[model samples]
Each structure stands twice: as C-alpha cells, then as structure tokens.
Target: MTVYYCSASYYDNCDYWSTSNCTPPGTYCHRGACGTCDNSYYQCAWANLSGFPPENSIADTCGSSWLCNDKHAYDIPKFSCGTVLWVQDLCNDNGLNVTIADHGPYVCKCETNCNSVNLMRIIDLTEAAYIYLEGSFSRGHIPVMIQT
Candidate 1:
C-alpha cells in the first residue's frame, strides 16, 4: 500500500486567508463552507472483491452517476474513478466493499464534519456504509482497515 499525507501547511494559509473554502495549491475546490480545508492522511491498497448497494443516492466530487451507496469519498490521489475497496470498521469488526466515486474529507487546519472529528480518518463514508456496518455516524469517526 502507498501512504499519502495532506499537508497541514497547505491548509494553514487557505483556511486563514479565505473567508470561504479556497482551492489549495495543488488541489481543486469542491463543495464547502467558508474557512474550510481538508487535511487528512490517506493510503492505497488492494481489493478482494467488488460490491454495490441497492441504491446509488449520493453525488461524488466529480458529480458521477453512481457512488458507493454510502457516499464514500477519496483522496485526490486515490480517486481513480472506478477503483474498488474493501473497508472494515475496526469499531465493530464489520466491513463493506465500496468504490471510489468522490473526493473529500478534506483535512483542513480547522476541524469540521469533513473529518468526522477523527483527524486520522482518511476515507469518509456516508450513512449507507455506516448502516451496513451497524455503526453510528454520531460516533463522529471510527477506526477502519481498508483494502483497495
């Protein structure tokens, strides 16, 4: 697996200088409120299988047709359009197979819903993934093991 880090320094200037979310030096800006940036760590790995949910209800960063049912987003480097991933919820030993359809959880200097309160979070899953794993989104963030 390949590991990647979102630079804290990149977020510092963007978060402090702009009243709204501004594009970082090397990344594109998506949907966000003012003074927000995503500063998180990420990685790439292998996948065992592919799975799809009953409903594709979320829009990704690119505004694609189908997302991973639970709105799973990816880091810029990891967003390969149709890449598959197997993610496990360390909190409950549950897992789900999903695809990279969006970009996000931008780790910024300030804390926000982007990272779900867990600064270590690399991938952001929507309600569907959480429900499939029988996890609570209110937990803010849960530890996870992901297989690309």
Candidate 2:
C-alpha cells in the first residue's frame, strides 16, 4: 500500500504541524501537505464502516448486486472490483479473506490521527469484516497488511 500524507484542509497554513506525525520517515511535506517520500508501503490501520452504523447499510462500489454478507466485502484505494485481498490485522493478530468491493478513504486522514502515514487507515472495510478482526465495532479502523 502506498500512503500519502497531506495536511487537513482546515489546517491550511501548517500551524498545527506535528513533527512526528507530519514528517515520519519516507514521507514528504510542504505547505501543510505531505505524500509518500518513498514507494514502499508501511504497516497501518485502515478505516471501516463499523464505526459508522449508517454506512454499514450501504451498497458497495462493486455494484448494487454485490452483497456485503459474511464479512467478505471491503474497499481499497484503487484496486479493481473483485480482486481478492488477504488481510492480516496487526493489532488483533487476525486474518480475513476479503474482496475489493469499492473505492474510498476518499481522504487518508482519520478523526483521531491526522496527516500521519503510520496512523493512516488506507482501506475501508465492511462492518462485519471489521468486527471479525476487531471483535467489536468501537474503533474506526485497524492495522492490517494486504496480501494480493
């Protein structure tokens, strides 16, 4: 996964710059925006629908025909629909086999962690899949490595 770090639109002038979060290794920052300093991927959490109950009821980008049952559906930045992703949740030490069903994280920044690649939630998961790895729906994201 390629992670890009950019300043929140609201933090327009870099006033809220955080050295550790904004300038981690292998990242670039300028004018309150940052991006991948290197092409390598890092281990980080990805956002999930479990945090937002309303999102759990929506259809995936794959199509209206696709069903998000059995915790098998997920979304990533730009993978083609139907691609299989073997996800290993780092924090929970759990693994799940999911498919790319949509496109999102439309923004890399999360509520608690902002402009930080290491804390970024690169992928988006269905509520069920998230619960499978997290054992609960309290967190907005989880750390995972995606195996194609």
Query: Tens digit of lDDT per residue, candidate 1, span 81-123?
Result: 3565676655566876655444334332222233433323345
- Per-residue lDDT for 1-148 in model 2, tens only? 4432211111112122323345564233432112211111221122332333324322232333432222212432334445566776666568776654433343433322222234334465554566666787666555556676
Worst window of 10 by summed lDDT in candidate 1: 40-49
State each model's CA lDDT, in order: 0.37, 0.40
- How much lDDT does candidate 2 score? 0.40
**What shift in Å separates residue 3 of candidate 2 from its native position after superposition?**
13
Highest lDDT, which number?
2
Q: Which parts of model 2 are misplaced by more than 4 Å?
A: 1-78, 110-117
TM-score of decoy 2: 0.43
